[model samples]
Target: MFLILIKLAWRNILRNKRRTIIASIAISIGLAALIFGDAFMIGMMENLIKTATDSFIGDAQIHQQEFRDTREVSMTIQELDEVGANLAKEANVQYFTRRTFAPGMIASSANRSAINLVGVQPSTEKLLSQIDDAIIGGGFFEKANEHDIVIGSKLAEILEVALGDKVVVTVVQAKSGDYFEDWFRVSGIYYFADAAMNSGMAFVRLKKAQQMLAIGPNVHEIAIKFTSTEYGQDKQVPFWKTYSQHGNEALSWTEILPQLPKVFAMSEYSKYIMGIVLFGVVIFGIINTLFMSLYERMFEFGVLRAVGTRSFGMARIVLFEAGALAVVSILLGAILGFVLTTIFANIGIDYTGNEMMGVTVQEFIYPVLTIEQFTVYPLAVFIFTIVAGLYPAWHVAKMSPVDAMRRSF
Candidate 1:
């Protein structure tokens, strides 16, 4: 009977308490590592997504169909008021800001450098991006003139300009193609993890940029913050379709930074790699333990064979013993993993100000635990342990009663 085999398997492992405990611990450590590795990878990917989006790139962006390719000021978003109304009514949109970018030159008395000028509404920009918090000197649009400007600290160093210094800006008008020039006072200086941003970008008020560019209230891009970042990643979301109409294009951060999704895809392989590596060591440990246990109980196996027990029944007993060991190990490993993940989830791992591939992590990462981590991982570990017992099971079943009896002495 299966019940009799189960009882025999449990009783046999208990014969050498220390050896069984050690084997169980070995498998348990591997299972626990698998669980922890899955949790950590999930947390890190989330942090990467959050950082990529929150670092001046919103969860999603809306733009004219031809705008991104050209980077020409002429390709501004159409029906600006209608777009604003729709965004206001959309439940998924938390905050949105209008922006226009220009390739221009900024010059101070000491030096002049080519720059990318970004126009923004300071109040709404703070709601969407971390530029407000990244300021190292002065303030972001603190009740200042329409001519006020915020330049990067790196740009400031290049231009030899500081807060309160005068800088001349030059850009071509979108429609007439006539060159326009203006003077702006440097109101603030900011620092970001991206070297390009710190070295080449400057911020000025939307109103001033519009007036100078000869475009009235038309923006090249509308960056959107969503209710949840998940909505941005889900390509099937109705939000993308609804707004991606009327000669415009709507895109998630994933689409904007195509490289990030590739990196995310690569991260998925880490779980399988970790499982293989951890359980690879455990396979040998389990086999050795089972072989040792079988040899010590050779006299009992010999008596069973002599009493007319079939080979299938004997092999099944060894397999059942492996299952029992796996069950105990799974329990301990699950408990250990859950405890470690929970403790760190509360504490969180600090990775702020760390940049990778032009994106910076601006917050702490809390490990995310899911049902798959506990259920699927443990089940896989159990199956792996069962398979590891096969060779030992086969060896024990094929031996003759006389040979088993002789090995016992």
Candidate 2:
């Protein structure tokens, strides 16, 4: 009986070719919008998160218990190997890098400024941070060692220095509580595209930084990155809880950079608002199409009812028509959306050398579609389509066969 009703609905839709075509086109366009919009938003968020993680804040970081709170040079993580072994044991951990950090004074012949000096292993940092790829002038760590420095473009400008220029770095030694100085030649100039980082942060070899600070083998921090799928999962919390012992503290990106999570939440809220507005438009279009289609079929409905077809059967026919239309339209929309997203995903939208909301894109932004996006868009459209059919079906149910036939003629 259901199959027969579906067959009848199909025949009814075909009978009015122009109306069905127009209605289907409207539905297809709406569905396509939903799919594409979702893909774009999700892709954008993923890109931002990736940039944040890869550029500096990995997925998580490990530091001495009071390190982040105080930013004190004395709060160095002493048990590097033990923490590293624990991190390595975690299946989610993709990579980790050791870092020594200090607040220091960088002075050139022309200018002087206070800056955050980071000590990093060149080999590990190449895999971990975008800083290596971000060098616009001079090569990364080429002929660069403990006595060489990689400074940000803005910092270079402030110091009135260029590549190969000698600069004096001064830092307070953690153990002795006394100031020490070292001279380094600027080996590379990098532009992170972040004003704050570019102006105030510089990089050097970890051993050199430790030696300069007289901290021996102690590192101030360990940055960890997890696999892509593991990012949104609160895998860091579990790892932190398990490993945050023996004066160790694990902090996720959300913890270290609190504002980023808030930005993500705001973007999600915006997407919801956009979705509601877009879907509202779509629902209205579907309702209008369903009403027009039902009015044209009123005579046929009344004839069927007079010939002993149940009132419920009339309503069912309308619903079946809507369902069939939704299935076909959504399929077409999905295909169109997928093709469009895939094309753009490859080409990418370039916002290079520009900062949006203080977060700069490494290169270009790519649109990525997830399985959930595809599923949710079609499901939402299907539900709205069924709801759209309800009003027309209810109108048919209220009408007497005589009245329906009279009105239709």
Candidate 3:
């Protein structure tokens, strides 16, 4: 019985090839828009995460309780070795490194700038952060080489410092109710993660920072990397709980980079808005074509009823036509979307010229190809098409055969 219905539906569709083509094209285009939009958003998010994580914070971090609230050197952790050891034991732990941050003034030949000075141990720093990869000029800081510093590219441009130029770093220390001043030279220049970090950040050796700040063996924070970034949050919870039990505070990258969630949420919202617009246009086209086809087949429907076709059977036939159209359209759309997205993923779409959230951008924008984006959009379109066909299908089912047969189109 089902096979007979399918055969009838197929024959009916073949009877009007032009209408089928039009409906299929509508569905295909709609599905393509949804898939491509989702893929583009996903790719952008991935890029954002990669750029932010590599250049600044790692997957996770451990900081002293006071440091989490106030950005002051007084919150420096004294038991660095113990915390590092505990974090290294976790199965998903990749590597960990310690850092100290202080607000200081940097002076170069061309200009003087106020920047956040990050003190890092040269060897372990690479494990925690990708500062090494972001360097566009000169080498990263070395422990043996004292009085050397790495400044962001924007900072370098502003300071007019080159690869081998000497820059001065001055910081005032408050120890035992007394103030001590210290200074160091710039050794390297680093490119910014974005415009913000570039214009106002600098890196230097931990020993050099210790010597300059006169704060020996004290670290403000420990950054951690995970073997797999996907389960970073899950892994972070237990670690934080364990550390918090011992009176130390651990922070995940999410907490440190508060803007990441907002960015992700905005992407999702934008995708939804785009999806609605695309689906509406596609549905309008498909429904208009289907309505015309149904009107043209009024006499055929009447003849079927006269020949003992039940109302339920007639409704099923109409639904079958809608479903078939949906299936064909979704398949074509999915194929086209996948091909275009794959091509774009390789070639990449550049948004460097466009300003995003008040920052000048760098690098190409690539679309992400996730299973949900490809499959879900087509399924949604199919469901909507099927549902939309119901009202028109019922209208046909209710028509009297005598009246329908007499009506002239």
Q: Top TM-score: which candidate number?
A: 1
- For residue 387, model 1's alpha carbon misses the true position, in angstroms, by 0.8
Across 1-409, the per-residue lDDT of candidate 2 in tens digits comes to 9989889878877877787777777777777776777777767767777787889878888899989878888898857788878778888788889998899999999999999999998887888788888898887787746688999999999999999999999998896879988999999999977787898998899999998888888899888888853563475357878667788888887777677678778877887777677767777777787788777777878898888778788788888888887887788888888888888889987876576545776667788888976788789878878887888888777779998788655
True-vs-predicted CA distance for residue 53, candidate 1, Å = 1.5
- Report lDDT (Cα) of residue 183, candidate 1: 99
User: Could you give candidate 3's per-residue lDDT for residues 250-319 as a string of tens digits?
Assistant: 7776667777867788878888888777777777776676678788888989998889989888888888
Please report the TM-score between candidate 2 and the true structure.
0.90
C-alpha positional error of residue 323 in candidate 3 after TM-score superposition, expressed in Å: 0.6
Per residue, candidate 1 scores C-alpha lDDT tens digits across 254-359 of: 9998888887787788679878988988999999999999988888889898788888778888999999999889999999889988887899988767875456
Q: Of the candidates numbered 1 and 2, which has the greater TM-score value?
A: 1
Clashing pairs in 2: none
Residue pairs in collision within model 1: none
The residue pairs found clashing in candidate 3 are: 149-187, 153-190, 167-186
Who wins the lDDT comparison? 1
lDDT of each: 0.89, 0.82, 0.75
Q: Model 3 reaches what TM-score against the true structure?
A: 0.91
For model 2, the local distance difference test gives 0.82
